[model samples]
Target: MKFSIERGALLRAVARAQSVVERRNTIPILANVLIEAEGDEVHFRATDLDIEVVDKAPAKVERAGATTVNAVTFHEIVRKLPDGALVNLTDDGASGRLSVEAGRSHFALATLPRQDFPVMANAEYSANFAAPAPVLRRLFDKSKFAISTEETRYYLNGVYMHVAEANSGRVLRCVATDGHRLARIDAGLPDGAETMPGVIVPRKAVNELRKLLEDDDMEIAVSVSETKIRFATPEITLTSKVIDGTFPDYTRVIPTNNQKRLEVDASDFAKAVDRVATVSSERSRAVKLQLDEDRLILSVNAPDAGNAEEELVVAYSDEKLEIGFNAKYLLEIASQVDRENAVFLFNSSGDPTLMREGSDDSAVYVVMPMRV
Candidate 1:
């Protein structure tokens, strides 16, 4: 395989594909990025059994052929090359090596046979739809923070994406939880997505998809099946196996009749939580929030370390309330509130609390309280 591609274009494509390649791979070919050059384009494909990402870049093809090379090494070489220098990649098949040449630097990397790369079989999608990049980004970005990292409960290790009924109408939703906190975000359902089956998009795929949705105005084509999901842009396609498990019915976990209300500046609240958390013990970073009328005081007390306290004037009218929560969880949920005020609803110090950005119900967060 031989092709010449601009440094910027080649780097971008290889970077995207390489990110999906795991650093430690039991399979030799799994560590390689498959490079296929044909016509006027070159394809960089990488996979780790469960997930596959293919990136296409325009290139001047000297000979149409395909080969595989270590993704990490190829990416590092291209990243260090002089900016704007044309990169030439060539493989003669017999040498079992791939040659990378730039203006004044050249390196040859061992090549793996392209035939050994495992490609996921094509899936018949039950639902296919298009959504604005911003819409998809918001859905995943708001909820991904709550995705569980526990491998035992694999179902909870990803964002649960599905169609559901909202107050306004049917909407596309993404919900994630790690038992202590939960995030549910809703977006207007796009056409042809009404019958979409709910799927748990693994945390890795959610993260990879975020990179593709960075362009706010770009439209993304999404395809969903029972076992696989695909998000495609004009230049890249990301495919992953859906977590084959059922997500818990999260509705019961969301507080419904929490009456005590408190509204505070989201940024200020997050900062206070972060500051107080510094003095907390590493094992349990607990922060106590004491609310009375329109005043809110945040304090952290760790016997081993020192203590911290901060007070901020907030909007609260209900009876006085005192609650304790994990400092990390508070900071994460508070950061999701982009608006000036974060509206929090509380039932009691023992029950789950709900929070949202101003009066927006489209994105709601539930955080379970902790004992200080």
Candidate 2:
């Protein structure tokens, strides 16, 4: 294989692919980036078995062929090369070594057989739909905070995507929960998505998908099957197996009858939660909320560390009430409220509380209370 690619173009493609390659691997080929050159394009493929990323870029191909090289060493060498240098890569197919040349610099990397790379089998997707990048961004951005990292409940470690009924009619919904808190978001359903199966996209897949959705208006094609899911754009396609487990019934955890309502500036509330939580113990991050008439005070008391309290003028007319919740959970949920006011609806001190964007029912959240 022999090809010459522009420095900028090569960097962009290799950087994306190499990130999927882990630093250490028991299997030698897993640490290499598979480079295939044909026509005027070169494709770079890297995988860690579970995830694979392939990126293509325009290159001047002298001879069309394929080879694999250490991903980290190649990336580091190319990164240190002088800017605007044309990079030439050549491999004789028998030597099992790839030579990289740029200006007066040259380095040889051991090659691995391309036949050893593992590829995920294709699946018959039952549903295929398209969504604008911004819509998908909001869905993941708002809900990712609630994704659970607890390994035992692997189903909760990703955002659940499916169809559900909303106020008007059918809507696409994404929900995530970490047991203590839950985030539920709804977007207008795309055409032909009514039969979409509920899929728990693993956490890693969600992060990789976010990178592809950076273009605000780019339309992404989504395909889902029983065991695997694929998301594709004009330049790239990503496929992964879905978590083979049932997500707990998140709807039951959502509170519907919390009567006491308190509305406060979201930014101020988040800042107050941030400041007060600093004094709380790490294990039990409990913060007490004291409310009366039109005032709300947030306080945290840690046995080891000093206590902290913050007062803010709020829009509350309910009788006096006190409730406790994890300071970290409160801060995270409050930060999600984009606008000025975050409305909190509380029941008794021990039950789960509800929160939403002021009076907007489009987005709803629930947080289980903690004992201070």
Pairs that clash in candidate 1: none
Q: Candidate 2 residues 1-372, lDDT tens each?
A: 999999888887888778878788899889998999999999888878777777889999999999889998888888888899999999999999999999999998899888887766778999999999988888888899999999988888899988999887899899999988999988999987888999898888888888789898799998888787887887667777788889888888888788999999999999988889887559457889999999998998887888999899999998898989888888889988987899999888889999999887767889999876
**Candidate 1's TM-score:** 0.98
Q: Please list the residue runs of candidate 1 whose C-alpha ends up more than 4 Å from where it truly belongs after superposition.
A: none
Q: lDDT by residue for model 1 over 185-286, one digit each (tens)? A: 999999989989999999999999999999988999999999999999999999999999999999999989999999999999999899989986584578
Q: What lDDT is reached at residue 118 by model 1?
A: 93
Instruction: Quote each prediction's TM-score.
Output: 0.98, 0.96
lDDT of each: 0.95, 0.87
Candidate 2's C-alpha lDDT? Answer: 0.87
